[model samples]
Target: MLLSDQAGQTAATKIPRPATLRESVIEAIQELIVSGQLKPGQHLVESELAELLGVSRQPVREALQQLSGEGWVDLHPGQGAFVHVPTVEEADQLLAVRALLETESARLAALHAGEDGVRRLRALCARGIAAVESDDVEAAVATNSELHAVVTALSGNQVLAELASQVARRVRWYHTPVARRRGMDSWQEHTALIDAIEAGDEDRAAQIMREHTEHTRASYMEQRGSQPVEPAPKPVRRRRPRTSPTD
Candidate 1:
């Protein structure tokens, strides 16, 4: 069956270069979690995930391991992986830390924000207000995160910005459920914070930011308390089919 072709030609050689399958699966699963398609504490069946992601079980397994290490998924001894259910304590601690970091960020931003920085903050605030007005909670929440991130960036402290970025995604996950409840008030607070920053009122900016984050934390806690936790199912072990010895 030899032909006029290289003997070592391979499937890998024929494929175009792009992200690895494992990385792609990881991002897909994260998106599922972030978008709330995969609820917290929901069971993750490898076969189901493989079918949904159009991938084989092997890459899904590897991605789950990576996600488990990253705190997004919990790997059980025999039950397999489930979405990590955030505890109230974990949310409170993270939000408290965010408040500390962001209040400092607001003060630094007031100290360093130039005309362009102020203008950018105002623009994000405008977008956030518009989203809220239109009742687009998701867009409003996203814009809210962007506005906070810009304030962090305007702080001009690389270390502070890095820390804020690390906690930002998880913050968004918790914030999404409560966005509508906080809607107009959240944007109103943003407007006031922008005003403080624009006026170079460092103390006022810090105070407003602290209050804003605290309000969000309270709203999230209230909403989390209202929702019921889904119970984890007992694992079912598969039984081998019995076969009789034949002579």
Candidate 2:
């Protein structure tokens, strides 16, 4: 049955998806960033991005705004949008938060994970390890994220999982640089963590996860410390022009 709104627009059984084009463009840009195709601090040209993505400038503009809100892109007024470059402090703080949340998640996962969940984790671990072995940095990073996501899901805590999901991409951003360096060791730790969870050792699982996350945090800090920090340009706010009184 169709219903009419105050605007006299007919509402059928279905409604058009809101901001579908903008959302798709947002995902595409995020993928480019996460995969390192769009390097940090690289300028994002709206027209070029629109042409590349086969979308219009309007959607690209909207997507850049959304990405900026999410910290994936920085929009500088009068200048343009650029990919966000992670600071050492940002990486440390974010990873610290991740460790806290993931530790508890590991405890819950151990308490809640079933055999199928354990099997799935093992499969993800294998894929990550294989990616590292092949020196496929992008694949390794992606699989690493998947492995952590699965662990969070296994926790069976809806709220915790949601929070993890929110920060997962940012975490991926920081992990990209260290993927190759941390690869084998990271996956080995995943194996140990999975064993702990599979054995239902909550304490062990939490401890392992805490240590594993700390390792990544330390790696990021060390690596980023050596690199020069470039401050992101802030957007200039335009002021309204003053007018004289009319005669």
Candidate 3:
């Protein structure tokens, strides 16, 4: 309980354990889902995933169970595992909560961000803009997240930053699908947010954050409604041979 006792503890306590197979498998599967390689409602076959991931089925199976518990995957009694399909309402609600948390984060960031913090934001915004210009959706999405993270951290509120960090990962997943569509406009919005923060305009920063999150939510809604239903494959007809002509 005392400083002397704490000093007696070896650095060995700080060394982290290596990831177990199951833990690694879970992370891999989560990456696949987050990258959109595993589409929503797509079947997750243990054997196939094991082969793809170069692990045994046991770890894959365990990973699926853990993911299902986390609401990232769905496990059906007869159907095995499938990626969770987020609903319109779910996306809207999640983004709404994100907006609430981040709007305040931006407000505090404006009040607390130093010149160095503003510089970091500007650098990230430049990267984001370049990514959009090059049509690299993935890179743009990553930079966008990094820029927001800087703003959150600059808020000088540890609790709010932590909450934003937790939501940010899920937000990245949802953002990936819409990144290409959001494109230049998203970066331009970032530009505005950075300006507000640099000017120490707390009200304007908060308003920009709210509108930015709202735009993403609206984009998700539009994307959800616009998903095209695939037409069923038609059966090929075989023509009967003319027996008389063949003879």
Q: Of the candidates shown, which would achieve the greatest lDDT relative to the real structure?
A: 1
lDDT of 1 by residue, 1-247 (tens): 4543545574334566799999999989987887678989999999999999998999999999999999899887778899998889989999999999999999999999999999999899999989989998778978888999999999999999999999998898888888999979998999999999999999999999999999999999998889855645656888899999999
Candidate 2: segments with Cα more than 4 A from true spot: 1-19, 232-247
With a 3 Å backbone cut-off (N, CA, C), the pairs that clash in candidate 2 are none
Assess candidate 3 and give its lDDT: 0.88
lDDT of each: 0.91, 0.89, 0.88
Instruction: Indicate whether candidate 2 or candidate 3 has the larger TM-score.
Output: 2
Model 2, TM vs. native? 0.85
Query: How should the candidates be ordered by TM-score, best one leading?
Result: 2, 3, 1
Tens digits of per-residue lDDT for model 2, 165-205: 98898888888988887969999899999999999999999
Q: Give RMSD to native, each candidate.
A: 8.7, 5.9, 8.8
Off by over 4 Å in 3: 1-15, 228-247
Off by over 4 Å in 1: 1-20, 234-247
- Clashes per candidate, residues 3 or more apart or on different chains: 0, 0, 0
The residue-level lDDT of candidate 2 at 210 comes to 99
